[model samples]
Target: MAFWTYMLKCADGHFYVGHSDNLEARIAAHQSGTIGGYTHSRRPLELVWCETFGSREEALAAERQIKGWSRAKKRALIAGDWDLISELARCRSRG
Candidate 1:
């Protein structure tokens, strides 16, 4: 079974991160407001980034790590800017 770590760009311009075994169903739930909570009010979300993982643990780990990231780092991740992400991490560690 495959797991997924996904990021949604919400209507409020903030990002929501999550992981699920059923990516399509989970996303649909969020879109329909059935998922509720943070994403329910921030509707009309756009899926900006996603990655598949071999296990639920991996996907959950990714989700948790992403949730802690700064907005700039998250943007860098969405943009696939590994260099920028690394630089940002270094800057964060130095501070």
Candidate 2:
């Protein structure tokens, strides 16, 4: 089974990171406020990005890593700007 790491753009213009084996169902839960947490309250979410992994561990690791990123870094990822992603990582390492 493939696991997925996904990002949601919340009502308040913030991002949420999550991983699940059933991406569609998980996003549905968040959208319906059934997820019952940050995304729940934020409401009206839009899935901005998703990446599939071969294993649950890989998906979870990607989720955790993305969660620690700055908003700009996340935006870069959502835009599929690989150059900016690498530049941001370098800047983060320097500062």
Candidate 3:
């Protein structure tokens, strides 16, 4: 089965991170207000980014890692800014 880690660009201009095996259903749930919590408060979200994984464990790990990243970092990923990602990647390795 395939799993996916997604980033939603919320109405509030912030992003929400989540993982699911069924991306379509999950996004529908959020759009219809069937899901609650952070995303509920920021309704009408847009799918900003999504990466598929071969396993749920990989998806979950990516979700956790993304959730811990700075807002700028997350935005960079959403924007598909590989240049910025590369810069950030290098920064993390610097002492």
Candidate 4:
């Protein structure tokens, strides 16, 4: 089964990162607010980005890494700006 690392743009204009084996169902749950957590209260959320991985471990690792990123970096990722992402990473490391 394919696992996915997904990013959601919450109603409050914040990003939420999570991993799920059943991306569609998990997204539905979030949309309905039945997931009962952060995204739940955030209400109306948009699946801004998602990427499939070979294993749950990989997906989870990606989710965790993204969750730690600054908002600018996450925006860079969602925008598919690899150059900006790389520059952000370098700046973060140098700080």
Off by over 4 Å in 3: 92-95
Q: Pick the candidate with the highest lDDT.
A: 1
Q: TM-scores, in order shown?
A: 0.98, 0.98, 0.90, 0.98
Model 1 regions lying over 4 Å from their true place: none
Candidate 1 residue pairs that clash:
none
Q: lDDT of each prediction vs. the true structure?
A: 0.97, 0.96, 0.93, 0.96
lDDT string, candidate 2, 1-57, tens digits: 999999999999999999999999999999988888789889899999999999999
Pick out the ten consecutive residues of candidate 3 with the lowest summed lDDT. Answer: 86-95
CA RMSD for every model?
0.5, 0.5, 1.6, 0.5
Tens-place lDDT digits, model 4, residues 1-95: 99999999999999999999999999999999888989989979999999999999999999999999999999999999999999999999999
lDDT of 3 by residue, 1-95 (tens): 99999999999998899999999999999998999898998989999999999999999999999998878788889889989987886887794
Model 2, global lDDT: 0.96
Going through the candidates in the order shown, the clash numbers are 0, 0, 0, 0
Task: Give a tens-digit lDDT track for model 1, residues 1-95.
Answer: 99999999999999999999999999999999999799999999999999999999999999999999999999999999999999999999999
